[model samples]
Target: MTTSSMKRSQPFRSLVNRLLDHGILPTRKLILLLAGGSVAAALGALAGLGYALFWLYNAFLLLASILDWRSMPRRGQVNVARILPEQTDIGRELTVSLVLENHSGQPVPYRLRDDLPFSFERPPDVAGVLSAKREIVTYVTKGSERGLYTFSHLYLRCQGRLGLWEKQAKLAYEQHIKVYPDLSTVRGYLQSLQESLIVDGKKFLLKTRSGTEFHAIREYVPDDDPRYINWSASARGRRLMTNEYRPEQGKVLTILLDCGRMMGVELDGRTKLDLSMEAALTLAAVALRQGDQVALLAYSHEIKTYVPPGRGLGHLHTLIEAVYDLQSDFVESNPLLALEYLHRQQKRRSLMVLFSDMENYLLEDQLGAYLWRLRRSHLLLLLSLADPLLHDWSRTAASNSRIAYVKALAQRFQLDRKAFQQKMTGAGIQVLDIPADQLTLTVVNSYLEIKSREAL
Candidate 1:
């Protein structure tokens, strides 16, 4: 072996020597030999012959010690490769794969305990297993915050015969995984919408009306525009057509998210704030694609993140990154302050989308005035979470006092939701009360519907 190799092997050799010198290697064998020799000697005494037993005991002890020492396994070399997804979305499961290779020529039987990042938990099945080389697959559900995650160490335990002793070695491997705001579903929806606009001729604009911005003019029909009628051509028996106008481009869209105590409540597997953020990201993406300049604001008692009105793919990236790490405050969201901030920031008329749980008590107590002020300039759309678990519980309740109590609570919450919707509608606000699973889809549909109406 080279000098460097010998130097590297010296520590383990010294450890083995120390163990041998302390009699740890053969203590059990020594005790067994001694006990057998004593019994034999006692029997011999009764028979008046004792000298041979002592020689036999020494021979057995020597043999057993040599065997035990030889049976102990050596620590093997290890290599590890880690695989992870390129990017992960919040609230979705991401899989990480670990492959281990053993370099030792001997078949080293060892147990492996991979040290995962604190943010992740190992799936139950992987909690057990040991080998020289093995593969472990683990999953972690992404949280609201987006950032880089690193995994660093793999621990190995080597067992000796009889399971009396083990040698542990820690191997170091470095890897990083990037987490980004989820946008795949939104991109797919936009692609579908673009296809529909391109292939469907019936939905295409045919005629332009007065007081509307002219978009395009197609072949004239029986009831085509009179002003665009080319009267001289009509006298010549030729068809006439009018121009069609789509709403002027550059309409502003504002998305407001409420990150407050109500949004902090967890339902199913994620907090309401998490669902809202995902929905907001989807809405922003769709709006930007539709030629509308989009702005975003996240607020509770105070502003958390705000992206001023902008258009383009770069703006979308900026907005997503800005809100990725935002969290809900424990305090009640101040709707009055939020509206005032909106008014000050937005100078032009815009379509404003608000995501918040508009519980009746909170709205009546704190937000009534702000709602009035917001309606003057912006076309407001409010989106709220509809708790499915409460609905299911109410439907499945048993006929007992305990169940009756739960039913009453569910009914009250439902009534409160209704009141909240009614109040917003009364104030001319469009509201969407959707379940968590449907929030992204609902938001996308709303944007499309608005686009079709030429509102943005």
Candidate 2:
């Protein structure tokens, strides 16, 4: 009704009128009417009046169709706009709305379909009779892939006044949305953030250790350490009080993400790279919350993305934008190149967490030396995803020759992975080989442990 909105709809209305001029399709009502008329003509033929009755019936049908077409409302009479969110997370449900304004004065029977992205489920057609001045229809959709997606062209069909034909129109409306990794882990952490120790899906009171920065002084509980009792504060407050020390913060954490062929392996319907990105995001959130500067480097055969060290919640948004559309490339990862680049750009000591495939690192024989040298300057942690299938295969009973061979191979791979982990640990490099589902928790805990130990 507003002048501004009416002006905006004018051009689209004109476009809709042009598009609706293409064709008209007969409706079921018209078809049924034709069939009944044919039956009547057959009966008239048996009565010896076939030719005249047939021609009369044909002329009547033609007249009805013409009158119906003239009385029908133009497709441009209804103006529609799609409302969509600018961004959403993978596997998260979102609501899409179609806002329709009817200016035709009469009711319009219409059906609509939106051109959704390939990763989204095809929503059923929307069919209804619009009699109101304005109406809004909404549908739920979820994206399975993480990337940018566009929705274009809303296909609409409207029935004529006499229900004889349906006019079709293709209206152009484009909307672009970015799909990011799931943020459930980050949200859960924030909800229970007051609790210090999170272990295996459980929260526990933090047992502050000595030789750390003082966090706060709280009323002493039975579980409070006797050595941490604040005698002066206790006397002044007339109650037992203890000094709580927290891990030192303001350290730099560098997340080295490997988007290569190996990371593309699928597990539990999600790629390893997807899982890694989620874990990386969780770690970055935790570190940034602790007032640590977080940096990100995503690379495959070459550096795909690099976000310099930054702090605060704003930096987290920067990281999300840089990697939300990143995909794994079908090429070998060059850790050497990544390390050299990091060395050149960064000179300060920081904690380097590498999210990569263990097999890929093992295959690159020359990567060890570079990693060892990098460890001397920065605390290096390699986080790798363990395949559950391989673990299951290793435990399967060797009842047949084929089973025995598979079990042997699995065990061999496990042993090799374990030995490599030990070697890295002995060299003062931390490593965590966790399952896809457990990566977020394990990586966060490892970072916390390293920070507590003041390793960086």
Candidate 3:
């Protein structure tokens, strides 16, 4: 949390009367009048007029402050509860709610300020009224980074009727909020796919092209093959319709996530792993919706987490949980270990996707061997990010010797990576090396193409 909270919660009286001792909150009209009366008393002491007036004025103002402070709601007469999100997507603004209940049966005005994490945007001042018995206040803030965030303290002040004194209290309600990489982009893609399927009138688990498996019936589209048309259903519906086929269930999809040192490198202000996370989610969600069993293995030097194969839209949640908290390790990754583990656990042929950084893979002598071994059984597809900075450096016209040398080096790396891609393709492994910014869309399209070709 950004702000330091008080060591212990003080009583409402101690908090409200704080302005009376060692503070300047009460130094307004009443204090000015008291100061004026004191000067008059000193000056008129010879005339014997303002002495009584000074004491009366001071006593009256003191009595008023005391009365206003005492009018505040006592302990147990007011209850406050905070509602925190279960987990928030990193860099997304989400609303936090507060339920303020007033048992004092009077209209109460309140000011609430939540102590948020340092990086998260602090919410604006939340002030409202409990018109009857309860009220709810909501404020939005964005979590600027991933990991666990906490909301430690609630600075609440209940105003008195006269507004002269406020009963301030620090409510200790620390909430542990998990900030995961933003998955909204992936979800949006998935939603789009689902909506398209509906518009095409295809069922979930749609089979692409020619297939023998029994699927549902749907309204015919212009591009649908005519051989699969159901004559009776078309006649009944009075429109041309086709028999939609669902592929034989259990087309296996395996995702191998690398949380290695290179994956931790920042691109476009976000780590490579973060972008890969979204791509992985998009693949898992879409494949699962298509009746494919989706599994994931997260690894760096060794296996960190593994989610077993499962199908259906609900299994997407399992894949998300398995990889959501994964952080990139600075150590070198061992895709060989992942291949070995999958070889033992997965006995069937599957479509495997490996997310990694290939910028310097050609320099690594042993990078291709692990994936080559996996390609013997699995349909291995290697996915990696293309740094936009490299494109800039490669195309930039160098004006001096230093920039010329830097551009030369950049071009060399780019050619090496291209050679590596050609070699991987020669080995029969599909390599989708794309810009980091376009990962979600490209990955989704590639997967659909694979399914469309019945390559599963």
Could you estimate the TM-score for every candidate?
A: 0.65, 0.90, 0.78
Full candidate order by TM-score, most accurate first? 2, 3, 1
Expressed as tens digits, the lDDT of each residue in 1-456 for candidate 1 is 999999999999988765532223323435665678878777777877666766666676667556644544544454556676666775567776666565544344445555666656554423333344554545444534555667677665544344333445656677776566566665565566443432122232212243356556555677755666545545555656455555456789999888889998988757888788877887787677656899998888898878899997678888877877677889988666667898999989898888988562345465666766777887788788887867887687578989888888888878778877788788887777898877776776676666667654
Better of 1 and 3 by lDDT: 3
Positional deviation of residue 76's Cα in model 1 after best superposition, in angstroms: 10
lDDT scores of the candidates, listed in order: 0.68, 0.86, 0.78
* lDDT head-to-head 2 vs 3, winner: 2
The candidate maximizing TM-score is: 2
Candidate number with greatest lDDT = 2
Name the runs in model 2 displaced over 4 angstroms.
1-22, 35-38, 197-211, 238-240
The TM-score of candidate 1 is 0.65
Q: Is candidate 1 or candidate 2 better by TM-score?
A: 2
